[model samples]
Target: MRVMVLVKATEDSEKGFFRDPATIEMMEAMGRFNDELRDAGILLTGDGLKPSSEGKRIAFDGAGRTVIDGPFAATRELVAGFWLWDVKDVDEAVAWVKRCPNPMPGPSEIEIRPLYEAGDLQ
Candidate 1:
């Protein structure tokens, strides 16, 4: 099964602050973790995202469309990064998440969700 691990963004991330020394260390640890995941054949791809302020969103309603600018209002509800994993199951994905280093400073979180496969529609 395929899984996507979502790293939730914080206000600092939304503002695109520079990484502190501790954060840089955390990144290096995360790189090691990624190496392990790759050697284990679970990680397909993963990377951190830039601040939402650098991005844009488009919404559709009926036949009308709207383009929304970024630096989005909901700072706490944005995504900071993600991992695409080909895992045995959700359980395995959970295990991997448990092993991941803190992706942010202070309190942070990563959410794991299963992806829908084309076979599911059959």
Candidate 2:
């Protein structure tokens, strides 16, 4: 099974906060976690994203179009980063996600979802 692990963004992330000692420690921990996943043959790909402020959003309504700037607040619910992994099943994906350390200082949340396989549509 394949899964996508979503990392939600926060205000500090959008503003490009400095990477303090704590942040570095957290990143090191995450690196170790990724190593574990790779050693277990689960990790396919993973990466962190640039701040939302560097991104752009476009919306189209019929003949009308609108462009929204970044540093978007709704980003709190948007994906700031992601991880793709191959696992045994949904249960295994969930277990792996549970082992991930929180990225943000506050209540960071990670959403895990299964990817659609070739026969899933059927």
Candidate 3:
């Protein structure tokens, strides 16, 4: 099975800032954790996104379409990064996520969701 681990953005992230608990030490720890995932052979890919100011959105209303740019207002709801993993099941993914270090300063969150495979729609 495949799963996505979504790292939610913090206010600092929206401001293009990396601070406090997100110090160099934390980055190094994350590197070690990523290495662990790689060694386990479950880490397919992962990435960290830049600030929301660098992003844009497309909106559609019937035949009408409009483009909206960022920085988006909701900081906590924005995604900062993602990790794709191939795992046995959601339970295994949860177990792996539980081992990850805190990815931001103060309070932060990571959401895990299972992905749909070809067989699932059939």
Best by TM-score: 1
Q: What TM-scores do the predictions have?
A: 0.93, 0.88, 0.92
lDDT of 3 by residue, 18-59 (tens): 566548788889999999999999999998899889999999
lDDT of 2 by residue, 5-92 (tens): 8988887666665778988888899999999999999999999888987888889999988899776778678777899999888889
RMSD of 3: 1.7
Each model's lDDT:
0.88, 0.85, 0.90
Best by lDDT: 3
How far in Å is the alpha carbon of 18 misplaced in model 3? 4.2
What lDDT is obtained when candidate 1 is compared to the true structure? 0.88
Predictions: Cα RMSD each: 1.2, 1.7, 1.7
The 10-residue segment with the lowest total lDDT in model 3: 13-22
Residue 64 lDDT, candidate 1, scale 0-100: 89
> Between 1 and 3, whose lDDT is larger?
3
